[model samples]
Target: MFKRILSGLLLAAAVHGLTITKPASADSKLHEADVKWQTVVNNGDLMPTAACQADAANCRTFNSYNQPSLNAKKRVVFRARSKGGKGGEPVHGVYTKDMSQAGPIVRVLDRDTEVPQPNNLSAVFIEPPSFPRIDSVTDMIATRGNHKPVWEYTLADGSDTKVGTTGIYTNPFGPLITGASKLGAVNEFAFFEVPEFPGTPFDVFPGSPAVTQGSTIVFKGNYTVNQIGKTGVYYRDLKNQSLMGAAGGGEKAAVLIANNTHTLIPGTQTVFGSTAPPSAAKRQAVFAGFDNEENPSLGGIYLAQLKPYPISKQPMLKTLVSIGSQVPEEPKDTRFNRLGEGVSFDGRYVAFWGAWGDENKIVRLYCPKEGNKDRSAYCMSAASGSSQDAVGWYQDKSVPINQGLFLHDINTGETVRIARTVTDFSDFVYWNFSGRSPGAGEGEEGDEDGEFARWRSASFLAVSSQIKRSKDDTPYQVAFKARTGALDTNNTYQNPVDGIYLKNRSEKSPFATLIQTGMDGTAFDPKAVFVDEDTGVSVVLPVTEMGLERDGFRNGRLAINASMGTEEAGWAGIYLGEFR
Candidate 1:
């Protein structure tokens, strides 16, 4: 394991801290890696300007699950979306993260393909690709023909030997596949039909199809157990391409993994659903979702896991700091109930977002103590000068109010905030989408339909608030604000904390050493890339100015700014961070 020398150093720093610990290594220095961005494609290459203006549906780049992974060629894989879902035109494409292998972008398949593919499609993976981990690989879930999901994988045992330059392998798409059959075609008895026998992965009818042998396509669609009487939740097999909780046991499909029931409380309209694209690989699927009400305060961000088989062995589901869900430590702190976006890889740490208001009516920092569950039940104040009791907590009126990114260890019950809204980070994150020519968008706001965000690897996330106008006809200056191009660089505004914010999260506490600060005696826009140093998470290298622009945020605000869904929803350019 990597040395744990940092923890003791952190405790001592809190005794003489500026809220954030000081950085002691080169890796912790802001922009330590000189994180520069490399742009991809001309803005016009996305979708037509008229199309986006016509409706948000017409101009989606369909870029989802954007964490780059190599194909057999080692090129980055991403989705090109249009109107998505069952018939959306989300074509898969590839290129280099640095655009070094530059050429025309390669489309995996489209209507013009030899087989003439469908229009609607989305590419979501259970595991993500990142830097510093070169020899690693992951599995992917993509559209064979929009929603007819197929698995694109590599052989784990190297069982499928690759032939020389000819680019042929014994198993091109790897084994455990049934070749790629549609949902209905696989099981003659339909997934939701009554099971001829229970406790098995098969049906009971004589005409039921055989246990799909080749590769079968799966669908993550809506299903109901009317006869058994169930309302919400779904359980689908990641490997075998099958659906569960349909035939037997009226058990609520409302579970995450095995038996880790989230605060899902028996039965309540405390609504919950997958809030972000899920990350998956071999036997595990790491994901985030939320339980909410009309009042934002009643909802919370949560992290959960799902296993392909024997679904009972699900990993634990931790409340990664539920906003609306009362904190077990401070049950009486009822005013702050909330939630947010998140990501995970290989079931490591589940990092998410959350926020709570304060009576201070201003932004501030609050640290907690792992006291003897019996120590004074108050938040630690910096005063008593020691983290031994409720003395390490303090508020700085200069900071923004509530909201922050957090990480939770599924294996361990530890959770910590990487940065707080308006304090450590500005709420208004930024991004670039060279698709939309600049005008038209925003019917509603939310990250529900792959709109406002993109999770790169489990440790990195890029978030944006609204959009802005084109300055100098260049994509780099598209400032994000409630109004078009309202950001005045000359003014020292407190700002709503909006703009593109790249958060490098970890399950560990603040670093023991702080990065260098700006002239104002503060560090704004510090770059960080969190990788597991050994048994826990730590910053390996500080990235420069929030990383690249992979995809558009949700389709919303003052004309095509950012969110998650619809790639061409705004006039912007896509860039990959130079993480050297």
Candidate 2:
């Protein structure tokens, strides 16, 4: 699951030119990690004075691109905004850092670059596994305003050697699903490839799906007639252009959830296909129903199991979670919206918003625990005054729901108040204070019985978990961090550049906002530091003199957006910082 660190003096004592050692405590070995923040691309770096109209005043870099990508080599790639635009054009150039030690910027494409479709050039995502196979210009998925986006890796290389396009989807009823009908009603390609995990075997499968017959594309096909439309999760085999799910604008297929795939997994080949039963170890998707109907046909969540490659059949859909099963978990007949499902890496569990209202409530183990009477507790109220840590010697007074991230287990229906959040949330931000068993593949937290079980926000980056204690031979509430939107303003806390947190589980509540900020003794507060709870090993990121901001964490890298300041002061720029 994650790498581990040792508890000992980082540096061995050298007494009189002789190496010496001493037995030290765990805290004694804790240290900080380096956070190297570099301004990957700024107006000063890219939109230089020469690029402007002879420095006729302030020539700011108009940056429409905020999401930056980092490959295995740590090379940065992002879209840059142009000074001017023509027609419906949006993004400027696809750029990357020069591989040299003093990495310079390199523009891959200009604002007026020719595209296959009438799309507003948005952002480029590097397919790391596909990058090396090709040339300097990596293989990537370029998403724009259009439904039929061009994922042409050959085009991304900037060699002027055109290869392919996602030819607009053809509809059997009238004509085709073009980019023009985007009235919240268009068949749009949402994601191109499966998301990458640290240990996942593959990232992207570079292919000529037309000739090779192996390309896979997931899209949201919306069917509209007289202001009425039905959208559903669509699967397309890029080779022959076959379809799955309700792409034909079928009756009842009203909406398709974009982010229904599991964390770090893109799920299956077919959205609805016939495949052999999947083992629990394999990756599967727990998505909201495809057809919006009252019947159980498309009720709560359906599991899409993957089939072997060259599979052109529709995926086998099983009711992973049913709306009927979920209705009982609601607050005593309180009407609620059908929550989308959040699948755990382990196929057995699914998390979702149990109930939403004044209180961001959750329901876990609605039925009963592994060994318990029927109609037991639905929520974690019993643990309300107790510590979930196995040996629960202390009672946690209460955790407010205003800024908390809760998880609802669909299987056992046991509720765990994972995080009492504070600050805000950042995307793709992840941290491992004390890591897991060596080479373990996402084993359940507290799987070691007395060991702590790690729980995390299924949708966001906020995280919480149990703690293993050595003395008691049982796990305890050690520490947890919740991403929040606001903090105790009465406490006079500064706004966090990165809105994630880490708090000790022992404290009744979070005392201060646990993020690194305003310590550089400068006006530009760009330092985004992540402090590990157990070791106190802080990863301090580099803060440029100019104001810097980030939208969210992309995996482990911080892509600098607008923190606080103008473009001339380095607002519209691309900054990349690795949290080692």
Candidate 3:
């Protein structure tokens, strides 16, 4: 319980209408702690031009980076692009750095790298997906490889060969297609087939795959059989070395956690219409599912056990929260309106995003068309003229969103509200650069695929069971990224300050702002600096963008994909902040 003095001071601050209130104690270690920051990579640094010939288009300096994933070993893996490579275009690939080793960034796999076996041997990788994940305990990385499909066929004698036209190519793998059939197979692929449902190979791995300790990989598999498409969340253990190829090996076959067809929507009479990618820790996984495939309005986050693969019955899903359930901390009649696609589970606790009530607002981004050659100048000028939104000629279609962050204790079945829109948070469904980059154009394009949009609600919450402050009482901690709301304030940015925050199960304040948009870059890096290209003026830029996902937060350290206001493109890179 908070002391009476602290409560009075906070009430006074609230009466004064201050957005943020700090603990007024000279020796208050409970409220906040110092964070040790380390830089991972930034733009303008010589990008590792591996696999590409030395004489290739000077594929030297990095241009941009996507959200990064950090593992327990202090290893960081992310997707980055370097322009002027080979064809005067951007060269992209998955790159990693072992912070424990303090070594240079190493290219794990790139566009120029060959697509491994089970696919066309001669084919090279196309654009690798964003947010490649690292295992909690190993160096293995799981990413979707985009490449030409390797067709398979059954000959007259009923033997399968690489000659059919099914073209089921793009799949997620651990860079190397095969490895020892044991835990921590860093070289094996995440390939699997359901024996009961043959002919429907896992053709596509949607979103980034989640790899738990011991190398158990969980991912959403999209496949079709007899022209009927179905999607499900499945997991495969790499311990069985013999089940390497596309067929099942009895108990070694991939276990289906949940799917659209047979998986029932808890507390409802309907079956699941679709399921989202899962977040796994140990042998347990948690994910979101909807009851309607096309326009889902029901369903919630679910938990599934992953061990004892050859079970006698289907795995039972434990519902964390659902549509008809009462919203936590709200009026009795307030029910959940929608759940997000992203969820984080670490066996004990589940962190997720939920929206309720009818109060909604339109989140609009300046999204210009990509192929509008004739209207490019007009669009550019219109975009440049607006400082409120991204530079673009037209605003992207507005999204009516009302979302919040929540944490549910699996042990107690208690759902606690972390923050809500217009109160604790300004926005949860939309995010953007604090300021534009000189060469970084549109924040998002109108025609761009919404699957990878930075503004999705899925980017809001990330939970880790390892950040518990006290072993006696505290259970877990969660890190959430959002634009500042009524409860947060930054001196530098008059607009809602974007930040990544930390909250525990037993925090007096709702959360502690670990890092935010307007903080000094030096806190993250000692040598961090920014120079104006035109006047050669140099200054320390403030923090801008921060990574928003579970992979960014693990153990007690947070992997941040932050930027220092765009004054220097190189200022934008990955950083690690460890709370002490």
Candidate 4:
């Protein structure tokens, strides 16, 4: 038979208080008694059940009797009855402070009810107040009443303190005030003001604020008012209040702005010097998108040189391309795809991936030398039929390649395929074509379809993959490589058939090395490699992966954005180890 019972009482001691004991357990059968505290059900009805028995103050029973061992400590259990003839009801247990003869305490209901109820009653363990302990009070002024009604509390020092107008009582923490409406009770209240960094006229209200690492807090919000002459951005410092800083034009400043198409490409600046940049000295760059007023073409690129510190001189901004100007017109139609995976500047040449005509994939190169505009920019064609998927340029103006790698002279526009093959066009047609296809017919002309082999890059390292077949017609090896010139059949690891990722080393060297392997699923898609000329190490940022994966690598940080179906969630994270 099911028999509910209460076992011996257990005491939960607090951090700053003395320990206390409750009623001792008896070596006898316990009888159940209805608890004064009732639980409100989902249907808006209250149900009364025996929480525990007299002898067993902490023990309760459901289908199977739960009898505490004679010498065991007391534990309380609350059982819920199943509805609609459902068999056994599950019992839940909770620990509370020891209360020998306490009646009841109020517990605020978490869920909403039919009527607006303030609070509810529940049985709980209460610790007795320590002697000479003081509790600070705040006055809560009643807005509905003609004369303000105040709630006050007396401290341990025999001093009566008034809790002024809707504030919470805290032991040592500062006052948590609840705001009152101008004419009636406030429907909502929040701590919107930035406590540590005060006196800035920017929007401080966050949609969701999270407290991190003791005193640090992070939140996101939109700027509502852009007042002229006001600081645009501000950061609070706990160590020194006087070290606070702000930036941007009040009325015209926007960290993130939109283009004509309403695509959001906001302005962002990263402060790197020892001291924060003054408002006038701060350098800003805009991310191009449809919503931005300046640049409307989707694949437009720009370059600007800003002063590192001091507000004395204005920075120089240069327009790299005005939207569709990068690509050519008509029969030589230039299809502008998304910006290639990577970008970098070496104070000399700027290299990027560009698509021309329908089948001509090439690498676009530009030299920043003064007055060299007409002859400064040119295209280096890739392998005859292969697309130049991604590209990167080293500090010395050397191009990197992957898949169909090739090299071309900037001055002459001369191009050559880095890797050569012994298999002729006829061999490819004979193996891949059939009698039904034109190439396989007895009298039909055989067209070469084997021109698909192209290297991905020529600078840094170009990695590619291919399945090698054994003499017995069995798949033998998967090859990968990072090649500068033609594929070196002599060096095994030098031309790895399995994909590889290269990063620039940071030890004041011009050379870069393979830092990651593409064989692993976690490895990013190798796109463009950016190497720190001072350090030989480099960072590899991938443009697309198995599942439309896109990533960005800057400095030593990596960011990955993955889209799943209709919903997308991503995070910018850091990875250890220099790109060697």
Model 4: runs farther than 4 Å from truth? 1-286, 290-299, 304-317, 321-337, 340-500, 503-580
Listed in order, each prediction's TM-score against the native is: 0.41, 0.40, 0.76, 0.22
Model 1, position 273: C-alpha lDDT score? 39
Model 1, range 358-416, lDDT digits (tens) per residue?
53233233332331121222223233222332434433322214555555555556655
Please write out the lDDT profile of model 3 over residues 121-189, one tens digit for every residue: 365666564467776667766766554433344556788654211111212233354211111111222
Better of 1 and 4 by TM-score: 1
Q: Output the TM-score of candidate 4.
A: 0.22
Tell me the whole-model lDDT of each prediction, alpha carbons only.
Answer: 0.28, 0.29, 0.61, 0.19
Name model 3 segments beyond 4 Å from true.
Answer: 1-33, 51-59, 151-175, 178-196, 240-252, 293-297, 310-313, 368-402, 431-457, 468-472, 485-494, 532-536, 567-570
Scored by lDDT, model 4 comes in at: 0.19
Q: Which candidate comes out best when scored by TM-score?
A: 3
Cα deviation of 334, candidate 2, in Å: 12
Candidate number that wins on TM-score, 1 or 3:
3
Ranking by lDDT: 3, 2, 1, 4
lDDT at position 59, candidate 1: 55
Please name the candidate that would achieve the greatest lDDT relative to the true structure: 3
